[model samples]
Target: MDKSLNTEQVSVEPQEKRAAKPVDRPFLAMLGMLIGGFVGMLSETSLNIALPSLIAELHVSIGTMQWLVTGYMLVIGIVLPMSSLLQRIFSTRSLILFALCDFIVGAVISAVAPNFAILLIGRMIQGIATGLILPLMFTVATLIFPPYKLGAAMGMIGLVIMFAPAVGPTLAGMILGLLSWHWIFWLFIPFLVVAFILAAKFLPNVGDISKPKIDWLSIILSAIGFGGLVAGVNLASDSGWGSPAVIGTLVVSLLVLAWYIRRQLASKTPILNFRVFKKSQFTTGSILVMLDFAIILSSMYLLPMFWQNGLAIPVALTGIVMLPGGIVNAIVSAVAGRFSDTISTKLLTTLGFGITIVGLILLLLASSTSPMWYVILAHIVIMMGVPLAMSPAQTFGLGALDQQTSGDGSTIMNTFQQIIGAMATAIATSLLAFGSSAAGNVSHRIAFTNGVHVGLWFTLIVAIAALLLSLTIKGQKWA
Candidate 1:
C-alpha cells in the first residue's frame, strides 16, 4: 500500500508520486514540521527570562506585561477549534509553508518592536503560526506514516516538543547574557529558514482537501468565550475583579461557552468532542493535566519575574538555576509511561501531586532574602512533580475513550490545557498586582517577592485541588 493514502480512503490516492523514493522519506516529510514545532515551543518558554527585561524597557506594569504571554496563548486557543476545519480546507504543505512564512514576518516585527503594542502585535502574529503548525505536525505524521511506524513518530514529535522547553531557557539565557532580548527573536530566522527549505522540499501534500461547511458559530463562540474570559481575568489586576468590565466579560464568556458546549453536544459532527467528558476517568485525568499545566505555566511566568525583578538575580543565573528542572522533567516524562505500567495511574498521580505540593511549599517560603539553594531545589522539585503526574494522567484519560472518539479526546485535552494555562498566568499577574499594591511602602525587591508569595499561595491551592482529584481516580477508567 502506498504510504500517503493507504488507510486514508477519504480522498483519492496520489496517482504518480515518487513510489521509489527513499524509505526514510517519511522521516524527511516530518522534518520540517518537527523543526517548526521546536521553534514554536522554544520561543514560548524561552521568553520567560526576557519578560522582566521587557517590562522594564517597555514601561509596562506587571498586568500589561502578561499580554506578551497570555495574548500569544489566547490566539492559539482560538485557532485550535478551527484546526479541524482548516485541515479539511487547505493542504498540509500550503498551511505549514504559509505559517512558517508568517512566523518569520512576526519574528522580524518583534525583533524591531519599539514599544509594547508593536511587540504584542508581533507575538500575536507569531502565535497564528504556532497554532496552525501544532495540529498539522500530528496530522501530517498520521497521514504519511504507516501504522507500524506511528508510535515512534508520535513519540519523536512529543519528545521534540518536550525537548525544546528543556533547552529553551538555557539557550535563551546564554543569548541574553551576551546580547539584548531582541536577539532572541532574531535567532529564530535562521532555523526557520532551514525549516521552510526542508518543508518546501520534502513535505507531501496530505489530508483531505474538500471544503466542509465553515462552522462559523463554533469558531466564533470558542474565540469570544475563551478570549473574553482571559481578557476579563487579565484585566482584573489593573481593574479590580468587581469592576464592571471584568464582571461583565466573565459572565458573558461563561454564558457563551455554555451555549457552545450545548451546540457541540448536539451536532452530528462536533468540532470538539465534549462528549469525552462523559467518561469519569477521562474527565478526572483532564482536570489533572490542566491543573498540572497551570502549575507549570504559572511558575514559568512568576519565577523569571520573581528572580530577576524581585530578587535581583541575573538573567543567565536565573536560567541556569531552572535548567536542572527542565532536563529532569523531560527525562522523567520519557520514562513515566513505563513506570505507569507497574504502578497504578491513581497512585502515581497522587504521589506526583503530593511531591508537587511540597515543591510549591518550598517556593512559597522563598522570598527576597532566600538563598540560591532554595530557588534551585524548589524549582527542580516542582519540575519533577509535573511530568510524574501529567504523563500517566493523560494516558489514563485518553485510554478511557472508545477508539472512535480517541482523536477527539486528544484534541479536547490539548485545547483546554492551553486555555487553562493562559488563564492561570493571567490570574497570577492579577494576584501579583494586588499583592504589590497591598504591600505598600516596601523596597522594590521586597514588594515583588511579597506579590509572588500571593501567587504561590494560589498555586498551592490549585495543587491541592489536583491532589484531591487524583485521590478520586478509580482503577477502572470507565467509571
Candidate 2:
C-alpha cells in the first residue's frame, strides 16, 4: 500500500498527477525547510545573547536594544497574512526560493552592519522572510505528501521548528563563548546558500499561481493593527498599562483591527479572507493554537532566565540545564503526532497542560540549595508536557481544513503563534523587570524567585483556561 494516501479509496490519478515526481526527494526537500526553520529560530535567540555586546559596541540604551527584537517581531507579524496570499499567487516552489533570497540579503546586511540602525533594518527584513518561509513550508509538506505521511512529515517539521527555541540558548551560548556576536548573523549565509542549492536541485515546480496583486490599503491597515497591538503589549509590560503610550497604542490597535476586519468583509479580494473564522472547527482550533503559543513562548522566556538569574548560572550552563528538557520534547513530538490520530485531542491537550503546570509548581519549589536531581526532574517534567500538548493541538487544527483551504488556515495559525509569542515574551520580561525593581535590596535570588513565581502562576491560569477550551473542541481524526 502507498503510505502517502488514506486507506479509504479516492481517485488516484489526480493525486498521482498532483503528486511529487517519482524523482522527488521528500526528505532532502524537507531538509531545506528545516534549515530555514533552524536559521529563523537560531537568529532569534542568538541575538538576545549578542544584545549586551551590541549595546557596548554601539553605545545604545536598554530601550534601543529592544528594537533589534521588537522590530523583527513587528515585521514578522505584519507580513504573516501575506504568506497565504503569496501561496495563492505563487507556488510553494517559487515562494520558498524567493523567501530564501530575501533572508540571505537580510543576513548579509546584518553581517556587515556597522551601526545599530542598519542592523535593525536587516533584522526586519529577515523577520518578514521568516514569516514567509515557515507556513509556506508547512503548506508545501501538506501538498506533496499523502495524508498518511503527513503525520510523520509534520512531526519532523515540529521537531526542527519547536526545538530550535528550546535549544537555541545552548547553541548561542557556545557561539558567544567561542566567538564574537557578529558570527551569529554571518553563520546563516552559508545555510541560506545550501538551502538555495537544494531548491534548485530537488524542489519541483509544483503549482502555477502568479503573484497576487498587492492590496496596499489592507496591508497598511494590518501593519498598523498588528504593530500597534504588539507595541502596546510591550509598552504595557514596561511602562504602566495606564500610561498614555500604552493605552493609546492599544486603542489604536483595536480600532485598526476592527477596520481591517470590515475591509476584509467588504472586499471580494481581501488580503486574508475573514470567512475562515466562520467555520466552527477552524475558529476553535485557532483559539487553542493562540493559547498554546501564549503559554509555550512565555515559558521559554521565563525558564532560561530562571536558570541564568535565579540560580546565577552562566548562559552556557543555562543551556546545559535545559538540554534534557529540549531533548525530551523533541523525542515525544513524533509519538504525540501519531497518538493524536488514535486518541482524543482534548484528553492529550488537557493532560499536557496539566502536567506542565505540575512541573511548574515543582520548579517553583526549587531553590539554589535544591539538589541537582530535583531541578532536573522538574525541568524534564515541564518539557515532557510540550509535545503531548502541541502536536495534538496543531494537527487537530490543520486537519479540520481541506487541502485547498489548508494553506490559508495554516498561515493564520502561524501568524497568531508569532504574535502571541511576542506579546507573551514582552509581558513576561516586563513583569520580571518590574518585579526585580520593586524588590529593592532583596537578594537577586529572591527577586528572581518572586518574578518566576508570578510568571508561573500567570501561566498556570492561562493553561487552565486552555484546558477548559480544549474540552470544548470536537476532535476530528485526519490520519
Candidate 3:
C-alpha cells in the first residue's frame, strides 16, 4: 500500500473512533450547522431581487453591479475545493466558529458599505463563509448521524440548501418592499447572530486534527484553475466565446487544472483526493447531483425573468407567484430524504426527472397570454421534481463513501455544484440571447419569451439526460 494512503487511513481512524461513540446533543449540533448553513445560502440568492434597487441607489451599471453576485460565486468556487484539506487540518468546532465569524463580519461590512467596491468585498467574505458552511454541514452530518437517520438528516440539510435559494427572491422582494437595499444585509444580521450562538453552544469537535503537510502548489493551482475556469465561463455570456479574454482565461484555466490534477494524482498526500472517483457510485451520484443543481438554478434563472420580463408581472408579484413552489420544494425535500432511507434512490430520482420534464414542457408551452395560475402550477411541478431528485441523490452519493473519505466526497460534490451552476447560468443566458437575436424585429416581450422557451428547452434536454442516468443507477441503497 502507498505510504501516503496509509497515513490518510491512519488519520481517519481517530475520527471514526470518535464518531463511533455518540456525542451529547447530536440534534443541537445538527441544528446549529443547519442554521448557519441556511443563513449563508439565503444570502446568496436573496440579493437578486435587490439588484435593481442597488443599481439605482449606487448609480452603477447593471454589468458592473453584477459582480456582487458573480464575485460571490467565484470566491465560493475557489474556496470549496480546499474544504477537505481544511477539514483535515481544523476541528469541526473551530472551523464552524471561523466560518460564522467571517459571515457576521462580512454582513456588517456589506450593511454599512457606501460603495459597490466595499459591498463586493463584503459579499466575497460572506462567500467564504458559505463555501465552508455547506460542505461542513454534510461532512458533520455523516460523522454524527447514524446511517439509518442520515437520509432524513441530509434531507433536512437539503431543505436548507434548496429551500434557501427558493425563498431568497421572495424574502428579498419582501424586504425591499418595506426597506432599502442595505436592510437586506441587516436582515441577515439577526439570523447570523442566532446561528453563531447556536454553533458556539452546540457544534461539536467531530473531526480529527491531523496537521498534514500543506501543499502550497496545489492550493495555488486550484485557486487559479477553478477560479479562472468559472470566471471564463461566466464572462462568456457577455464577452462572447471567441473573445480573447474569454479564450485566454479558459486556456490558462484548462492548462492549470490539468496540471493540478496531475499533481494531485502524483502526490501521495494530495490536498484534494481524486481517488474518490475510483468508486463508480460516487461518480454517478456526483454527476446526477450536478445535473439536478443545474436544472434547479437554470429554471430559477429563467422563470423569474419570464414572469417579470415576458408577462410584465411586477418584481414583487413575480416573487409572490413563485412562493408556493418554493414552499412545496422545501416540504418535498424533507419527505424525500426520509423516503430515501426506506426506498431506492434510483426510483425517486427517475420519478423526479419525469415530473421535472413535464414541468419544463409546460413552461415551454407558456405564452405571454398564459394565465398566472398556469405559470404558478408549472413552477410548482418543476420545483417539486428538484427536491425529489436532489436530496436522495445527494444522500445516496455521499453515503457511498467510507467515513474517512466523506469530507473529500462532500467537497467534490459541492465544488462541482458551484462550477456547474456558473456554467449552466452562462449557457442559459447565451441561449436566451441567441433566441432573442433570432427573433428579429419582434416585440421585446415576444423576443424575451422566445428566449425563455429556448432556455427551457435546453434545461429539458439536460433533465432528460439526468433521468436516463438515474435509471442506470444500480445500487438500491448506499453500499
TM-score of each: 0.86, 0.89, 0.92
Q: Model 2: how far is 300 from its true place, Å? A: 1.7
Q: How many residue pairs clash per model?
A: 0, 3, 0
Candidate 3 residue spans exceeding 4 A from truth: 1-21, 55-64, 477-479
Candidate 2 per-residue lDDT over residues 89-136, each given as its tens digit: 777777778878999999999888989999899999999788888887
Judge candidate 1 against the unseen true structure and give its global Cα lDDT, from 0 to 1.
0.79
lDDT of 3 by residue, 329-355 (tens): 888987989988888989899999999
Q: Which 10-residue window in model 3 sums to the lowest lDDT?
A: 13-22
> Each model's C-alpha lDDT?
0.79, 0.75, 0.84
Best-performing candidate as measured by TM-score? 3
Output the better candidate (2/3) by lDDT.
3
Could you give me the TM-score of model 1 versus the true structure? Answer: 0.86
- Model 1 Cα shift for residue 293 (angstroms): 1.0
Q: Please report the TM-score between candidate 2 and the true structure.
A: 0.89
Better of 1 and 3 by TM-score: 3
Off by over 4 Å in 2: 1-23, 49-64, 112-115, 208-213, 368-373, 475-479
